[model samples]
Target: MQSFRTEIENPVVERDIIELEKKISLFRTGQIDEEKFRSLRLARGIYGQRQPGVQMIRIKLPYGKVTSEQLHRICKVSDEYSTGRLHITTRQDIQIHYVSLDRTPALWAELDKDDVTIREACGNTVRNITASETAGVDPREPFDVTPYADAAFRYMLRNPVGQEMGRKFKISFSSSEEDTALSYLHDLGFIAQIREENGTKVRGFKVLLGGGLGSQPRHADVVYEFLPTDQLIPFIEAVVRVFDRHGERAKRMKARMKFLISGIGLEAFMQLVEEEKTALPFKTYPIDHETYEKAQTLPNPPSVEVAEPTDESYLKWRKTNVFPQKQPGFYTLGIRVPLGDFRTDVARKLADLVKTYANNEIRFTLRQNIIIRDVKESLIAFFYQELKKLNMAAFGYNTTGDITACPGTDTCNLGIASSTGAAVVLEELIANEYPQYLYNSDLTIKISGCMNACGQHNMASIGFQGMSIKAGKLVLPALQVLLGGATLGGGQGIFADKVIKIPSKRGPEALRALLDDYEEHAQAEEAFHEYYQRLGQMYFYELLKPLSSTDNLAPYDFVDWGNEEEYVKAIGVGECAGVVIDLVATLLLEAEEKLSLAQESLAEKKWSDGIYHTYAAMVNAAKAILTSESINTNSYASIISSFDEHLVSSGKVSLGSTLSDIVYQIKTNEPTEAFAQNYLEDARRVFSGINAFREKEVNA
Candidate 1:
């Protein structure tokens, strides 16, 4: 096996790589030309993930569909550039990882040849436009959203207005009620709907805006109950313009569309949207109706007709995993990709199977599962047989839901523990002890190796975050249990409240106990999040109190949560580096030249030393910003501006300031350290000013 260090030394000499690296070096030197920087960043796979080192490269598949040829291209990229795995994110985007600094541009060109792109996939610009994977094929859907999604994508792909925003923008479309598109969590979520008036079916969409997840999670608000599909592009453009002009830019965390909607009440926001829409050029162009029709026409699936009388094993698999499509004699089988991961071999085999038993149609679900739609009822048995052969036939849907986990300590630099490992254990426990739970209830058990919430733990009914605690003298793994998060019905989804912090070793048992409690106490037919909501915080606090012992926790305390049992697992040891400012500085510098100042100051140091220095700089910067602020009306921007001025004047960047600046500057102009410190000083200030603003109406 070749070492990563060796691979780094033996750089791939692709054309894009040379140009991309030059631009990256230029950006690092603070000599960034915005246009060039954008081009390079997009050209390369450098995306701003919730964490450092880890870059979320969005591989664009026009109309949310990919061919086996495209799939192979992606697989090659995954194996060559990333972790030999691909992640199908909720936004209908394929995210590859462990990408090197130099190989990105080459990867982009490789994808470009296949008509896929990563342009504007990240940055404070329009991200990959997403549509329902089953857009045209799902018969229950009112209309194929593929065209609409494509139109929106084309319109926004390089729109001058989308060049820079207060924060990154996400858009998604759901053609039906399956809600697989995760419309509620996007910055702008659109669901295709139809209205029949005077015996005419008018195409329209229910538009949602300002919903997202991170440290603060909020569900999008419906700005328009219904707007004609033809008007969607303009409507979306209007919303983008509104967000661009008025969205909070000084405070990165508070700059998301959700915060904007929360600040001005949703109704007022809607009124603003309506006002914007009226002023905008509402034009409809010629859509490729032929292409859309072709997409809608189900390709004849390969003939592998099975005899009647389904095998019992296949029947059980179908009963547990297959979802009935509105199409007669057709189904969408869920192939559980546990921990939202799969080997490249498995991916290749699955792609082959799709070409064979299915109609060469495969849909990747946000749950990290794959749906092979257009599978004829007769071929179900053969499909299961092939799936079992490939070791991809796990009947783990909705029971343990395959444990929606991020590539935690194994691959992410920001992860606190082995999230994937935790997920595997959790899924195993549920599968072995309470197999009935898989069928009887709809439970979402999500885990993030860290608090960045990449795993969407904050939105799960029962969420867990990996951390460490000091068990007297030794450090031990621990997990934070978050209760009452859900995203079921398109409203602002509530974040799970942290009720208990227990050892990672005890996570499975603790979860089982919690599930048992839920089963015992929940009202008949109540959903997990709903039942937890009715139970309230007190009941959960008391129920999990016994698991909160710190006897076997870690000793290192990176975050001051005031709990000796809770510590941030040190960075560098995890799969992905932890959120160390030095690492972020290096990445920022490598991505663009302007970040060279911070990079030069902190480069070539040991990870621990670099982190400590970064932390101190951030603290000093925050203090400077806060001290400079006018007590009465100091906005986030004012503090950040003050901090930047201080950094320039003093020629010193503190650890806290570095961390805070990166985080805060991403949204607002506020100094990151000041914002964080302010949150600590007055929890309500953080809540009312940002948290509550983002999550004002979410059911807690």
Candidate 2:
């Protein structure tokens, strides 16, 4: 286990891995609290699966971009440390399941050699930064969002402000006004734009804030019509700072930024962001777009004689899966990864093919598919022939027939039913019976194992959420049918409305009913959502309500899709957003750890980072004392007030001024070296006072 430690080259990453190894040792020995250990492991992208003693590791790929070498490295790690299968997520991350918990540090070390990472992939941190797959290659894009997304990912990867937050935060970038990245559903969404002022073309973004989807979906509000490129990072930093300070902590479901904004109002939230600007290190952080402006190294021509495909299937694949790039004579080939699961053997061959005939780069799509860029126009047939052999050349790249689904009962602990299983049956039903829908781009179908919406089912034209229903004394798997959701470009969208619930066995029947009704009554050239809106949600409910009956059920109705055995409801506790129980001792230990990090940042001359670390240390110490008092607190803002009221007013722990006065200095003062040093010293004194009081009280 220790052998791979020495192989890591980056000192920061090596230290992170070593700390993980140490924490794992502590956890094994029962020295660390299970809840705290879960939080730690999750930040490293090691997620607990439904099955015990195994983990599902999420490999974070910023903006879904992966080079051939990186793909090769991921394949190697999956084969060595996990099952050979890779599951692509809607966020464009690749997950490998059934991995041993002890081998994760070594696995991470191996991936680091190829500049790949898993950190912050599945936790209450800044999750993977995603963008449109066609960012650089899209013909309508004003300028590529790749560099900006990369900058945000890099700036927030190990940033202290987001290391531990109320809940996970998501960010996305759209290539154009098309909003292909689904920016309306993200916490922070940016749509690329360019404006000409005084004969100078200034690149900027139309920024949206506080958007999210789950049980309650909220469309993002426009925060900025035009925010210059230079201010992107600073604005993000300010917002995260505000969220960390005032966002909910105790209520797991309400901890999202969307809820915070909804509760406090956007005007109040922006005021907090404005107050944080004084402490920001950069007022205008410039991104290096020139670095990404360089041309990609194109592949050489194919050497072997490959026959051109003239079959009907080939023509359909060409029409559906091939896209013309902005670069002349170059095309992008789309591979529809069903349920986003592909084996390492297929991955290795795809990697080789990209290196041989494309730009040696691939971007996993938000729809959980793969896009190969810079393929020469003449080589499209060759690529298709090669992909067909791998069983990855299916048509309907992003059409109605191409369904998006999460790994439900297959791997997710929180799964209520088999989403991937049901998805397979539905896709087969569409291909066999409703083949015309394959060419329809106006409709989408997405399925989630549960209402958590990991499959993004709530945002599709047609959606299904896995659920359970009772018939007399027996229980059966069911799906909550949703309809009328669609994304309108330029930061506008609508969440699907739940229409009805039907047995899992009758999902195909429900889909058929919806499609048939739309075809029968819809006006010419009307979209699915428009047709549904024209009729109304209750109208579709009545049409499919017949399939909801359980009285005529057969024996197969008792079983979930893709399963041979009878259904047994085994929903496990999810670790994605664990509710942390703070023990006083544990909180103090964390406070000390933060102090150490603050010292390290100060030594490295990172004033802003050091200041944030110092601020967190003070808050941790206060929360520890409050926990000892049985005074439960939620937000960090509450912790400060509670500490001041309970301890300071009672004269139990004395400081020169109010707790708020000292802590709010982070917002009032500039993050200069002198202020950072002073803040660290103040944190040390505050922690010492609290520790002394706690020890004395315990002794007494």
Candidate 3:
């Protein structure tokens, strides 16, 4: 038998309570080795998010399903080690924040005790497997995909081939027609399908491959109309193996499976998978259909005892947010969790409610939403009340579908602006200004702070990215708009074409104008994306000419910024920036509390005024670093330095400066920008350490 020690060889093992206490003492005494410290930190699930000092630890719930015990553990971990909050990701994963490196490993061990694994959560490997949360309960599903999802997860866990894929791989299974799994955008997508073979129903899947969305979005190709369920695992293994052998390993951007599918043509790739499948040395074990059936029949939900409701509000919710199940009088409720954010307390409450009303089950949707399956008619009222108390009773569904915003400047290291804050503001604007149209159209507006596209902006009906420009020696915040991307079922794809550029502050107005045009000119029953595409760019351009024009420019002179020679020909590449907080008083107070607890020295008297002043101070510091004689010596470093210099010369600081400061000024009199500069310097130091380490290993 394998020793339990071997099974827990990772930092999770060292994070045992006793070991953790010893490590904490070492860290407190400054005796910890830096490299080991970093490894242990990572092993414990603590990640240096996009912000300096603030960590985001991803808690992996295998198969996207967690027991009540696990949920409670997660809640406790977040409350004790993080920001007392949790974020439910689109991949059905949960992320907690503010965990320190010293506390990470212990937290992971705690999670391990509850059967959670955080391995490969962020690295260049197969990511969390996604499936229709309501897989077994939804009646519309031909077969439950939960078994397939679980089998795939076990088959791929720590598999050598998957340990180092060219890029992250995403796989999802949808057993229903509603497409709640967002299969169209995954690297690999499997949809349950059935066909009568000699009067017998044979279960299989329609396979999709290489679909992805970022700056260059593409829909998945339906390479195979049907593949037997038993052959599914081997077929997927073949596809991934092919990619492992031939996929580009040098160009990071071009390494995605989508690029491979595009380079090798769908027919050729499918042929290669078939050939490889024949020679594969392994086959997946048969699914235990009996066990699954028994699990499926565990218990029925309580029936509703009240009379059917006649209220329009409830009726609207039922129509838009509920999906029919194969079982009579049972339904799956799709609860929209706007922006994919929820508090830990709320999460616990939800877990309890699910236990009571949803047959002890819940599923997460790709849209950063949740679903309570097996809900009965009688329990609707109780479920409704609980959901309302948690502020999750909104019936938006596909109507005014919440803005999908990446954790831009707030936490991600690669943001150009505050995408989350911007999204919240834009959502509010839409709610207030266009309340009547909220339920009228299936419109999705997504925003990314930068081009990395964590928000999946490229696939939305409307999309925007944070940007900036130099205007008479001043850097002005701006946004780039994309239009007409909407994919219905099948492999039908539409790319979100660039429309115009405008001040970031004016995003709401721009959206309003675009929506107005859609409302006025759309043909009957036309989807917004379809309408925009059918109308062609010219008509919409003409309609939006007023908004596109610069101050004092005639309509004819207003050229689309996207079409400009510089933007058109320029390579769309940029580095990620560190995290930034909105400098509000409450946030400042929180920061102060953290600093005090850390026993860091700081002047707190002028905190309010100092915050605004920091922006300018950071700009100057950046200028000094960029113009330094040493920075100009290295060509690669010089390029980055020069860009910073340009921003500074234009009287601006790169937004990333907020998280890149080194030797942060703790005095309230010091500019907030100075602290940002210190953060940037710290980032450089870390990079230097990494480079030096790489060089030493190479020499050795």
Candidate 4:
């Protein structure tokens, strides 16, 4: 294996890259097991793709903020290590697909030069932190949530409590009550708020928790109607700590925070979080607003003869795709990049455009669009013309025509159908026939290749989740149509109701029928969600029932969109790396890895880190032993108790004390160097005992 070179000045980042390079070598040689290696790589934002022999690298961009330099760096990295295409995810992260696994360390090192990261962008860690793109410029926002969002991202990135979780956790910050960030469906959400108390104004947030969208979608509950801004990080850290201990692990489908809250009740979860306050590093984590409040605007460009746009299309574009900022004489332009798919060449052009005309920074939106801020009022037409050259000046920025979609069958392993394909079909349908709908902000159309809702289809006014329907003896590509979903503002939203299933070929027609019915029968100025509620689910079901027919289906019905070949049936149960692992050896290897980390932390005199590493080592070893006996190890909590019951009680293993007593010392003891050293030694002793028992079992 060749050594990867990194010029990163930070010791932490250099070590991280070196560790990844080392793990890649070990994994290639089969020295490290697949499951353990998967987790390690995922923490560094390396994810498996539908295509074999390659990876999908998610470049973490906090709040979707990207400077021109970073954008250029990303494009260069994409061209060098992957296909020359940049894919923007709904989470505000950029994904470059078909990257060689061996080149990832070098690719990461390149990105680091521009201060961009891929760390914690994938896997069961806290994913990228997202915020409303309009956060800083929103006229109605209490304050810019960018700094707060930035603080949250900084605190959680590689934080011990969030590094390895039961499942990926999502967080969001809404700029205003409009909740443009869609706080309703996040694991934890913060809505900017301010209140007058005794002649003084206080900054705070309306915090929502336990919300998620997947096979089962749940709206977040307001954990705090008003929580002081200073307490935000501490509260979230406590919650994450509680989740780390109690969240589900064995069942991937049931491992989200929503499931934990649903299973144990929100009150119980909150109580557990309250108990974790003692272990948190901070009682108050105040965000210094100056970090983002300093200067977010660029100087106005020099005077130029900007011709007035005479084209009717340009007028329509300005109406829907442009907005005035709270800052006087400035505006933000929304660039609708269809399906969030843009080539690297265009991305470089966009970077140059931003630097030349608008602010050097552009935000990738949650709607899978780009928002360019601080454009002078006079340069609107000029900006529009420049954007047109890149083929990105579409009229509907967040309207019905701008569909949000995940990279379905194109690259995602979990994709059941071609979401991007269906999205293109739907976009054309709207643009050609319903051009008037471009101004309709009340309507949202989203598509997901599967029920996981990566496309966030469940939260759209008209939603399509990828599915396949059995037609007699033949299986055909299909979509499950859902209706009535909408964000009601103030962190309130509705999850769409499932209406019916139809062939993917007829998705456009089904959409036509639904829109036509709403146009004909809805009351004056009726919102989509309101109209759906007024008319009820059964009404829309009957209207779309005609398109749901399987009779007299053509050959085209079996073939999905954006494919030349006939579509084979797919249930979207994409391959999981965990299931393919040799669980026993993988568990042992993970234990050894944790022990290594413990020693490294102790050597650095980091008591808390060393203690935590030791705790993780003990848990890992116990889990390996429990897995050997085929016991239920659903979570870290389960592993500890099961180790005592299946091994200690059975006399299959002994240390003269229960494994519970040995591990639980982490919670009771102070995180001093002496205690950390003792814990590390205990973990080493346990690892030896487990390995010796494994040897004896093999001999037998």
For model 1, residues 1-700, the per-residue Cα lDDT tens digits are 1122222322222333455666777767867654435434753336544455556576765544776667777888888777787776545567776676556766765665556667666566787776776776677787778778888888776554564455678888887765557778888888878899899988778877777877777877677778776677777876786676566654545767788888888887667666654334344444564576665544466577556446665666777887777778888887777766677888888887787667665767666677787878777777887888888887756455467887776645566776777787778788788877666436788888887677888888889888876666666667889988876654345678988888776777788888899878888888888888887989988888777876433333222222344444556422111111122223223323212222432343222222222332333334333333322112333434555564434544333333334533222322234443332333222212322222332334
Expressed as tens digits, the lDDT of each residue in 154-209 for candidate 2 is 99999999988989999999999999998899999999999999999999999999
List the candidates' TM-scores in order.
Answer: 0.73, 0.99, 0.72, 0.96
lDDT of 1 at 251: 53
| lDDT rank order | 2, 4, 1, 3
- Over 164-277, each residue of candidate 4 has an lDDT whose tens digit, in order, gives 787888999999999999888999999999999999989999999999988789999999999999999989888887787788888777888899999999999999887776
As a TM-score, model 4 comes out at 0.96
Give the clash count for model 4: 0
Residue 458, model 4: lDDT of 93
The 10-residue segment of model 2 with minimum total lDDT is 295-304
TM-score of 1: 0.73
TM-score ranking, best first:
2, 4, 1, 3
Show model 4 residue runs off by greater than 4 Å.
1-6, 295-298, 570-582, 603-605, 669-675
The lDDT for every candidate, in the order shown, is 0.63, 0.92, 0.62, 0.86
**Per-prediction RMSD in angstroms?**
13.1, 1.1, 16.5, 2.0
Candidate 3: stretches off by over 4 Å:
1-46, 264-279, 283-285, 298-316, 548-700
Give one digit per residue, the lDDT tens place, for model 3 in 393-419.
777665654777766666665666556
Kindly report which residue stretches of model 2 are placed more than 4 angstroms away from their true locations once superposed. Answer: 295-304
Candidate 1 colliding pairs, count: 45
User: What local lDDT score does residue 446 receive in model 1, on the 0 to 100 scale?
Assistant: 89
Best by TM-score: 2
